[model samples]
Target: MKIIEKMNIEKLNVIYQIFNEKDLLRKLSHQGIIKLHNFFQDENYVYLVTELANRGDLGFLIKNVSPLAINKSMIQFIIAELLMPLEYLHSIGVSHRDLKPENVFVTEEGHLKL
Candidate 1:
């Protein structure tokens, strides 16, 4: 779960914008760009329930893994897997402004998930 606190006006505005973009978020989930399960709002905070990526984000793995162990075939596979979701998003007129290793999640089955 992700929590957003409403302590300042700027934060509030950003939260409002996120809430306003629910349609796009849902579409992203359908396209495998994100795993948004559900969202809720209340007087104090906004809660987001999403996929549990037990293997954590790509950045953490990259930082810890040995460079020599990442062979050519593995690199190709990761790129190819990531590209499908990106292409789908582009075809639907959506762009992920924050595409980075930290945003990509890995699954326990050794698969990459957006």
Candidate 2:
């Protein structure tokens, strides 16, 4: 779950980005994108409940594993999997600005999620 402190909402741009992300997540329903299960705001913070990516982000994987351990086929598969969601987002007139290894997650079953 993502917890955004209400204190940060006083910053107009931060609030805008937060709500914008929520809106984008709400509209997206592709397999490659992270799933947003629920959202709610309390007096102190706003909560976004999402699916758990048990394997963690790609950045973590890359940082800990040996470079030789990641084969060509795996790299190709990850790229292909990433492209599907990018295509889907583009088709819906949405552009993801901050896409990096840290933002890409791996599911328990080894599937990718953006």
Candidate 3:
């Protein structure tokens, strides 16, 4: 069984927590770039959870557009659009030390901002 809890401790971070059973599962779930759900055990395993993106990441989107010979303006727009999320993540005190296309998440809604 898992418990869903909101851990908003400043020390942990803007969004930080110590997950238990359910909490650990949630951390393991695939969520936003910084949004992670995790679990762990001393003699066993450590569960790192997050919100999984069924739609996948921006890198995949760019790859799919590769063969299309996309336009400069369009590419610029996409770049700008993609950067929006990055800006938010940074503003929120999160840094993407390792940023890749697969690291990004596309939600069900058309909106794209972490």
Q: Which number leads on TM-score? A: 2
**TM-scores for every candidate against the unseen true structure:** 0.78, 0.87, 0.45
| Descending-TM-score candidate ranking | 2, 1, 3
Clashes per candidate (backbone, < 3 Å): 0, 0, 24
Query: lDDT tens digits, residues 1-114, model 2?
Result: 778888877765588788889988988999999999899999999998889998989999889889898999989998999999999999989888999999899899989899
C-alpha RMSD values across all candidates: 2.6, 1.8, 9.3
Residue range with the least summed lDDT across 10 consecutive positions in model 3: 1-10
Q: Which stretches of candidate 2 lie over 4 Å from their true place?
A: 6-12
lDDT of each: 0.75, 0.90, 0.49
Error of 2 at 31 (Å): 0.8
Evaluated against the true structure, the overall lDDT of model 1 is: 0.75
Of 1 and 2, the candidate ranking higher by lDDT: 2
| Clashing residue pairs in candidate 1 (N, C-alpha, C atoms within 3 angstroms) | none
The candidate, 1 or 2, that scores higher on TM-score is: 2
Model 2: lDDT equals 0.90
